[model samples]
Target: MTTLKTESPFIALSGVSKTYRTGNESLPIFTNLDMTIQGGDFVAVMGPSGSGKSTLLNLLAGIDHADTGDIQIAGQRLDHMGEAARAAWRAHHLGIVFQFYNLLPMLTAAENVELPLLLKPIPASVRRERVAKVLDLVGLGGRGKQNPTRMSGGQQQRVSIARAIVADPSLLLCDEPTGDLDRKSADDVLAMLGYLNRELGKTIVMVTHDPEAANAANRTLHLDKGVFVENEQVAA
Candidate 1:
């Protein structure tokens, strides 16, 4: 088992809280959320329905605002960053994978994977080379020309991972990445995620409901109404 490190945290969340207001009622999702993820660590968060898994991911990614708290990732504070700054920060420092494999249907797999790099000021030739390299790294070298819809679930997810890592971001956030796949496809995606964590040394924070998927992480934390009820290290 990999033991918890005493080093400085790569991702830190202190006193984070979130709530949603319906038309008539205010509902609290999670409160006083404190977490610290070390560099090169893979952590999984599991929770039942309505337990704020997606919300937490959004908060960590700087896509959503927390009611109260601080989020410091890769040494940058996200809780107070403006929208444009947060977008820029995310582009340079974070990689995110979604459950739906959010590839543009109109674009080919290579095109979809190349989207992130396009934001940078790199030359066209360099962009092309990087797109080719990342596609091949995710085992989609020849399949880059294929439409993502034509690929299997596992292959599409692989393309997503390729897209996420092309920038070499320090933090990788995955939200229910296996939610749309079958058992075999999910297993393949999980294996690819594991490879990213172990081989590429990405500090990953994944939100999953599947116990098997959670087991792939170095540690698993269980979230309930407002806090973590369990934090257990998984056997490597």
Candidate 2:
């Protein structure tokens, strides 16, 4: 694992631009956008539907390439790395939690959490240990043997979070993590995220439409038309 100094800016995007081309019509998402995020900080991003919030998350995840500019995370230049290299970097340094709880129907919760480790050269015993530990951390220690299809929406989302953190990634990117859950379930999930951020010191950038969800983070940034219109520290 790569140990990084937490005092510095863990993520930086400078003069970044991204656009999509479809049949000669250009759709611009971000232009000359710059942002920085400190390590071990939890930030929530809010924006309208077309404000490029999720696009920014995708850019940070290295799932999409920016048309221009430097994208650095943990002192690694993502804009300069090739697709395969970026994939390798993402596997080690990042974990992603999706809104829809993307769990495989064929696997149990434990098996799903163990998927990320399968790409590594870890021993079976170590993989099993990590999966169990993460599942327990997410309060799903007893649900490891259950299929996701048999679980509640909140339970499945917790399983998704377990899978994301099982690899011990330094950064976590969540996209509308509680969008599909009930009010109580959403609170539970948000509380868990806060716990992870506070206890594990995970650097988090969460894209959320719910103001209540954004309040869970220590800082909140509102994006409008690819620009950050407001940045505020949430009241403790």
Candidate 3:
């Protein structure tokens, strides 16, 4: 995880560009986009469909390659790293939350949380400890033995979050994390995110369509045609 306390930008992107080639046409998403995100800052991205908001998140998370420019996070240059190195970096430094929760149907909440640690060389005892700690963090300590399929949508999402943070990643990338929930459940998840940001010093970048979700963050940026059109701060 990140032990970065120095005040340099936690994430930086400069001259970034990405394009996709389809059957006959080439789609240009964005070009020469620059962004800086600091540690512990909760930032949200909002845009119309097909505006490349999720694509931008994919680029930042290193899940997709940018056609041009550079991306650096926590002083590490991501664009220049090899695939294996990037995977290792991502595994250790980032936690990603998805709208669907993505919890395995067959696994218990604790087992799902323990899955990420299986990639590491840690002892079983340590892995269990980490899983328990994160489960507690996500307010799912008692649901460790519960199957996600048997839990409510909100409970399942919390389990998903526990899995993400079980590795104690420094940065969290959420894509429509509250999109699949009802208003009450969405509020619960958003409040959990806010607590994580304010208490753990985790830097977060989220892509969301809900204005209420965006409002939960410290700042919101609107994207269009791959460019940020508005950047505003909201009091949390």
Candidate 4:
């Protein structure tokens, strides 16, 4: 396994541009955008609807491509890698949580949390231990036997988070993770994210429109028409 250099920035985007075309029309979302996220940094991106916040997240996560420029994560150039290579790279290095829980309905909480580890060759006993540890980290240890339908939205989201972190990915990407929850549930999810960043030294990049959600991050960057307009650092 290749280990990421701790001194290097976890993610870097330089002169990146993304463009899309429709019938007789061309649209460029971001042109020559430059961004860098250091290791252990919890960064928030905020933008209006259709401002390309989600697109930016997708690009970072290897789910989408940019038309031009460079993208490097953990010292690997993602733009030069093929689809299968990128997918494999992401499996080993990136953890993502989306707006929807995206949990497997038929699986129990423990099973859902263990989904990522299934890709690895670790022993069954080791996998079970990792699952238990991560579920407990997310405060869902007791609910491991429950199915998604039996759990609250918050609990389900915690299970989703446990699934993401169980593999010990180098970076975490969250796209409106709290968008589907109530205020209290949203707070719980956000607090868990903060705890992961602080306690586990996980690097996180989150896209959200909620001001309070942005406030939870160590630093917030505003996106306008796909470009970074403002960056504010919060006091710890």
In order, what lDDT does every prediction score? 0.87, 0.91, 0.88, 0.89
In candidate 1, what are the lDDT values of residues 1-236, reduced to their tens digit? 12223368988899998899999899998788898889888999998988888888999999999999889887789998999999999898788988999999999998999899988999988888888988887778888899999998889998999999888788899999998899998988888888888887888899999999998899898888768887566656
Lowest summed lDDT across 10 adjacent residues in model 2 is found at 1-10
Which residue pairs of candidate 2 clash?
none
TM-score of each: 0.94, 0.96, 0.96, 0.95
Q: How does residue 14 of candidate 4 score in lDDT?
A: 95
List the candidate 1 regions with Cα displacement exceeding 4 Å: 1-6
Candidate order by decreasing lDDT: 2, 4, 3, 1
RMSD vs true structure, all candidates? 3.0, 1.5, 1.4, 1.9
Answer with 1 or 2, whichever has the higher TM-score: 2
Give the candidate order by descending TM-score.
2, 3, 4, 1
**Lowest-scoring 10 consecutive residues by lDDT in candidate 3?**
1-10
Candidate 4's displacement at residue 73, Å, is 0.6
Off by over 4 Å in 3: 1-3, 234-236
Q: Return the top candidate by lDDT.
A: 2
How does model 2 score by TM-score? 0.96
